[model samples]
Target: MRILLVEDNTALADGLSALLRGSGYAVDVVCDGVSAEAVTATENFDLVILDLNLPDMGGLDVLKGMRARQSKAAVLILTARGATEDRVRGLDLGADDYMSKPFDVSELEARVRVLLRRQAGLRSSAVHYGKVSLDLNSRSFSADGTPIDLPARELGLLELLFLRAGKVVSKEAIMQSLAAFDDDLSANAIEQYVSRLRRRLAPYGLTVKTARGIGYYLDRPTEPA
Candidate 1:
């Protein structure tokens, strides 16, 4: 999932960015609320992590602006302010969840997964797409009732494609979804994974299409049983 993180503190921002990236989330970091609004308005994001304190604009204003424009992406506020009024205002202004600062990254990640899953309409921790099913809670995949063992990275890739099934996802977008900048993408890495997935799904007649100049999409045709 792609997330826009609006944080002003240098250390915390850098740390949070690294942690989220490590978890296979495409994250864009903006230190100011104004920039957060600009980016969130233009790009499609699955989630937004906003810090109430920003250099130029208040984070509440940013949340209010998003609501004013009718953007429905899930938002989680990360702020040091612990007052009940602050929480009430943030939630009242359309923030989906609130987390205080000095937070646990692990807990943040769990919440991120929950919010993203909610967006995808996945109730259980298990997610399915095409002919393959994934146990998100267990980090495993199965096809044709047979278990398919995949490396962690490939599993991450599969999860992403499954979430956005039927839509052509771009290479740049895929790269961003995969990892942080420091883990620079390897040449033909995406192609390799797609090829592997296609081969595995061949028997099921499910397909992953490559739009040559564009990107890839997962499509499956079902027959009456």
Candidate 2:
């Protein structure tokens, strides 16, 4: 999942960035509310992590802007303000969840997972596609109810494809989704992943069709990969 993090605290931002990265999420950090507002308006993110105490603008203004723009992405407010009024204000402004500072990292991760699962239209953490089933909560997958082991990268690749079946996901999009945000993964890396995914799906009667310079589309053809 991709998340936009708007936090000015360098240490906290860095720590949270590293933590989310370790949890298999691509996160973009902006120190000020101005930049955060811009990204929230333009980028299609799965969620936003907003801090109320910003350097340039108030976090509430950012929330207002996002809600005004009718952004559908989930917003989680993380700030030092723990008052019931503050939390109520945030919720009234459309923040999906609120967490006080110095909170447990596991709680934050759980909230993030819940938001992602809701966005994915899954009642449970596990999502099934054809004979393959992906358990987002456990970070595992199985084919035909049997254990089909996949490396981390391979599992991410499959998750991206299965999450948006029949859609034409560009190479750039795939790279951003599968590669860690700070990782210097090249376009060739995407090609290698695609090839590997195709080979893996071959046994399941699926194919990742290269769209002749456009991108790739995974087709579960009635025939085969």
Candidate 3:
């Protein structure tokens, strides 16, 4: 999943970025609200972690801007403002969830999972495609009831493909979903990941099909006519 984290504290942002990236999410960090607004306007994100105390603008105003732009990304308010009134205002302004400072890392991670899953309209912690199964909670993969280990990037690619199985996903969309703003990921790199994943999944009757000049899609093996 792709996430935009807006926070002014460098240390906190770095820590959270590492944590989320370790969890297989593509995270972009911005310290000010204006940058947040600009990024949201241009790029797509699955989630936004906004802090109310931005330098250029209040996080609430940023939230308003996001809604004004008709952004469908789920917003999670993570701020030092613990006032009930602030929370009410944020929710009334369309924040999906709110978390105060001094929060537990585990709880924050759990909330992130919940918000992302909710945004995707997924109810279960696991998703299945034919013989391939993905455990959302653990980020593990299994084929035909046997476990398989994959690199983090490959796993992220698989998740994106599985979520939109049967639909043609463009390379640009995959790059946006799998890479952060600062990530030096290129189209060639994406092709490499796809190739590796294709090889890994082919043994289990799964296929990652290419659309020639377009992108790729995930599917089961074709049946004989």
Candidate 4:
């Protein structure tokens, strides 16, 4: 999934960006609130990590802009202000969760997983497709209860396809979900990833089906007649 991280602290932003990317998310960082508002308006993100102390504008106003623009991405507010009113106001303004400064990175990561899963209408951390299962917390895949190792990009592709299992996910949609702001991910690259995943999962009776001029979907192997 993709995340938009808005913070003015360069060091903190760098650390969080590295952490999220390493955990299989495409992250884009912007240092101020105006940029945050503009990017959230234009791009699609699964989650937004907003710092309320932005230099250009207040982070709450940024959240307002996002909601006004009808962006449905889950918002997690991060601020040093731990007052009850601040947390209540942010929650009232559509923030999904709030985290205070000096928080644990591990907890932040866990909350991120929960918010993303909630956004996807998923009730559990692990989702299954036929004989395959994906563990969102561990970022691991399994086939028939056995672990399967996959590169990060392929794993991301599989997650996207598996989450939207029956739907035809367009190349454009996949690119948006998998690529960072600066990354130039082409349709050809998506095709290659899909091909590799197909080969890797074929033995397990899982297939990714192409919709010809449209997109792709994950398909279960046909049953015997």
In the range 1-225, model 2's lDDT, one tens digit per residue, is: 678889999999999998887777778899998998887887777889999999888999999999999998899999999999999999999999999998999999899989888877778888776677788876677777787777667777777777777778887777766654466778788889888888877776667788878788767644444
Q: Report the C-alpha lDDT of model 1 over 1-225, residue by residue, as the tens digit.
A: 678888999888888888876665667789998898887776667799999989888999999989888887899999999799999999999998999978887788888878888887888887666567877645577876789876656766767777778888888777766654356576389889888877766766667789788888877645313
How do the candidates rank by lDDT, highest first? 4, 3, 2, 1
Candidate ranking under TM-score, highest first, comes to: 4, 3, 2, 1
lDDT of 3 by residue, 78-97 (tens): 99999999999999999999
TM-score-best of 3 and 4? 4
**Least accurate 10 contiguous residues by lDDT in model 3:** 216-225
Flag regions of model 2 displaced more than 4 Å. 145-153, 179-188, 211-214, 221-225
Pick out the ten consecutive residues of candidate 4 with the lowest summed lDDT. Answer: 216-225
The model with the greatest TM-score is 4
lDDT of 4 by residue, 20-130 (tens): 999989999999988998888888999999999998889999999888888899999998989999999999998999999999999999999999999888989999887
Give all TM-scores, in the order shown: 0.77, 0.85, 0.95, 0.97
Which should have the higher lDDT, number 2 or number 4?
Answer: 4
